[model samples]
Target chain A: MISVAVDAYGGDHAPQEVIKGIEFALRENSDLFVYLVGKEGELKGFIKGFEDSFRKRINIVDAPQVVRMSDKPSQALRLKNSSMAVGINLVKEGKADAFMTAGNSGAAMALAMFTLGRIKGVSRPAIATLLPTLEGQMLMLDVGANVDCKPQHLLEFSIMGYVYAKHVAGIDNPRVAVLSNGSEPGKGNQLTLSSYDLLSKSRLNFIGNIEGDEIYKGRADVVVCDGFVGNVVLKVSESIPDLIIEFLKEEIKRSFWYKIGFLLAKPAFRVLKSKTDYSSFGGAPLLGVRGSCIISHGRSNGVAIKNAILKAVKFSKEKVNDKIESAMEGCFVLKELKGAVRT
Target chain B: MISVAVDAYGGDHAPQEVIKGIEFALRENSDLFVYLVGKEGELKGFIKGFEDSFRKRINIVDAPQVVRMSDKPSQALRLKNSSMAVGINLVKEGKADAFMTAGNSGAAMALAMFTLGRIKGVSRPAIATLLPTLEGQMLMLDVGANVDCKPQHLLEFSIMGYVYAKHVAGIDNPRVAVLSNGSEPGKGNQLTLSSYDLLSKSRLNFIGNIEGDEIYKGRADVVVCDGFVGNVVLKVSESIPDLIIEFLKEEIKRSFWYKIGFLLAKPAFRVLKSKTDYSSFGGAPLLGVRGSCIISHGRSNGVAIKNAILKAVKFSKEKVNDKIESAMEGCFVLKELKGAVRT
Candidate 1:
């Protein structure tokens, strides 16, 4: 049985939505167990409606404190008994196989880092997200974990992303590319230019540089970038579908024929929406941390939370951390740097 | 009459579309004169059918050399007699009010900087493009000029963007913003954090940092970013409409109803396409240069080139260069740096 620790007092719709998510997950996986960490009084009232069988799988670990969305990382860390903190501690202490939260992403990342520590040889942890592409989906790392990344950090992200794509996402010999302003080998900022040199020398399937426009074309399975660029790209991509929808809605309201066409084409739009939906993809995993830590969107609903829990379980069962450790062993830059240090 | 030099042997669809664009522009603006720069033999053959009256407005300047899109910036500069070079030289020699090209952007930028020279006190010239927003349009700068930038460069871009928005775009007291990973103060990488500090002290109507997702909301009239980030944002934004259409096309093929719905909604789709069309927006201007220089897309059609020509005329007539010069004179960071140098 895979036990997942979930922060109940997290996300916009806490306790209720998180409780519903736990129930949904429990129903989906009979062998799954949950340690729902939150205020006991609030969580108990919400979960009272669950079936006796579902109740048997759930253990409400009382933690009265709540981490507000606006709380800074330092302030959040001080909230030692908060649901987000307590839940991550559950994973650190080996009480749960993984931890899932739809809380403040920065706070969650900080708590995970402080509690779990970094994996051996990993310079810094990265937030890896699965973005939908024309073919299927691509894994992009350093989404928001490290705002300022050195070339070495990007290499580490590439390594972690390679392992996740190979083991978790099941892509054989995934091609890795550094995100840049241009696709040519020499076309990039100082960061990417230096990164290109390092990535080219690495043993992985490094495919040189890829521009922003070409990222959606599924040219590379894993795209590595600094958190600053990746974060902006992710947010910009997220807003496109909604912006298009808004444009379509306005157009539909302007013409009678368009309204009819939209009504008839609703099914097709539904399919598109589902395909681009972030919830279906589950949560973004904070890679390179010693434990399985998945951070969901702050606006996550029951379905999104449920999917995140499922993803966390799978992430733990797959022993992705172990695979990452082994992959780092073969990293050329890491070894070279270590050798340089020895001299 | 506003005389604009046109590079006939440029872009993907060259002489044919360019000649067509000149014809279109001549038809629209009675006072517009074009100095067509290309091979005399090739261009003369294409324009033989033009009415005698329209022919009076066009002056053919013979230049046998062509700057291919693949040519490097340094190589392009050496092609001194190339169509792009000659066209820009017209503006340099005061033979034309402005220059427009649908050729290589880097080539155009390099030729403009080399011939026309930078505006006094301007460290680097930037390319500013108008992006469609929810309300109207916003000007984003340094789209692909300098891949790497310092904090002061971003400050210069903001100043130039502000001047263009106010003078050419006719935005009243344009709200200038620095694009960053997060919206809050101090929420950015090293570059943005420093830029934020500089922008806050500047005389422009500076809004704080804006996130990528918020750019579409049209909150800021002018958005400033490093060319590397700006170029990626531009390409990514340009690809969205096409990507969405591709997604829709894939979905429509799956069902009979969707196909029929798409056919009925063709008009509305056409409206959306026209609204998002890059051609309608004309071209990006190489701001901070001594003379007006406009760079259109490589795939520019007749309509795009025509619009670009019209835009170049407006940009020159508005005296955007003079306004940018004045704006730079008021720059806080530049003044402080000069003071430091003196000390």
Candidate 2:
């Protein structure tokens, strides 16, 4: 059984949605086992109606402390018995194959780094999330992790993204790119310019630079950027569909014809909405951490949570971390950087 | 009469659309005279059928060399007699009150700085463009000028944006903000952190950091960012409407109901398209320069070009450059930086 530790008291929906997610995941994956990390009493009460078959797969782990979303990472780190911390600890202690949380992303990353540590040769862990592209999904890294990243760190993100795309997403020979203001090699700031050179020299199928507009075109399988830019881009992209819908609604109110048209086109709009929906993608993986750590959106629902659990199981089963370590070992630039640092 | 220098050979539509734009602008403003700089023979051929009254307001200046959109800024700078260069020269020599182009933005900035020079105490010129928000519009600066910027540059952008918003855009006590990953003061990279401190200490109506998603909410009148981030954000935002349309089209084809709905809502979609249209905004102003310069999109049509000419005239009439110079004088950060550099 691929055992997973889930933070039940995390995210906006909290213990209720998390319980539903665990029940859904258990029904789907017969071989999956879960340690529901939260207040034991609350979790037990929620699962009281579960059948013997479902109950057999779930075990409650008492984590009396709850980390609030607004709490600083420092404050969260001190709460060692928090659900998020306990779930990560289960992975660290080899009791669970992976850990999933829809809680405070900052707290989750802090705890994961503190408990699980970084993969060898990885300077900083990055959050890798899937963005919908014209052709398929593209993985974008450092979405909210390392805000200030060196060129080497970006290179590491590319390697991790490449492995994830190839192994998990099932893309063959993923094309990696540095997300920049312009697609041209010379058309970036100091950081991207330096990163472009490092990426070009790497063994990964490194396509040059990709502009923001080209991101949705699916020209690159993996797009790497500093956390600040990635986070901004992701949030900005997320805001677009809703803004369009809002604009459409305002326009519809202007005329009777528009109202009728909107009603007919409602199905198409629903499809468009579902296609751009964040919940469908499950969660972003905190790549380069020592264990499998999936961080879902704070607003994630039961469906999203279930998908995240499935994704974590797949990640653990594929042994993505081992592949990343081997890939880092093969990277000459990383070796050179390490040599320079040691000297 | 407010005389304007028009780069007749710049942009995609060139002499044809430019002549039409000149005609339109002349009709809108009786006091406007235009110096249409381009190859004399080609420009004359296009305007041969214009009525005497319209023809009287235009003067053709011979500029044999043309700067192609693909040309590098350095390459463009060497074309001393190109339409873009000659037109800018008109402003530098006080022959025209303003210059407008739909050509290479980098070339426009380089030529404008090289010929007209910077406003006193200004370190660099920035491109400020208006973005449609829920309430009205917000001005975002450094869209594609200086990619890499220091905290002082951001401070200068805020001051310039503030002045423009107050004087030209007619916003009272404009609220200026630094764009960052998070809305919180400390939630940013090294650059934004330093910039936030500088902005908070400034005399402008400085609001705290605004995230990417919050940009469209119209919380602040002016948003300041380094050109790299701003360029990416602008391009990414520009791509959204078209992407949504593409997704909607794909969905519409999947069902008969959607097709019927799309036809009915076609007018509403058109309204949405026009509202999001870049042409309606005319052009981005190259702020902090000594002369009034407006850089239109390369894909500008006659209507866009005309609007840009009107905007340039408004900018000149408002004495924006003079206001920016005075604003810089009042800035303590710029004065302190200058003092430290002198020592």
Worst 10-residue lDDT window for candidate 1 chain B reads B334-343
Q: Where in model 1 is the C-alpha error above 4 Å?
A: A12-16, A64-75, A331-343, B39-41, B45-51, B62-72, B331-343
Clashing pairs in 2: none
**Which candidate number has the best lDDT?**
2
lDDT of 2 by residue, A176-207 (tens): 99998767676788889898988777678999
Q: Score the docking of each candidate (DockQ).
A: 0.58, 0.66
- TM-score for chain A as predicted in candidate 2: 0.94
State the TM-score, rounded to 2 decimals, of chain A in model 1: 0.95
What is the TM-score of each predicted model, taking all chains together? 0.92, 0.92
- Clash totals for all candidate models: 0, 0
> Which parts of model 2 have CA positions greater than 4 angstroms off?
A13-16, A41-55, A66-75, A331-343, B12-20, B48-53, B64-78, B331-343
lDDT of each: 0.87, 0.88
lDDT of 1 by residue, A2-102 (tens): 99999998898887788888888999999899999999887888888889999989899999999987677788999999999999999989999999998
Candidate 2 lDDT over B117-161, as tens digits, reads 999868878999998888889999999888888887888898899
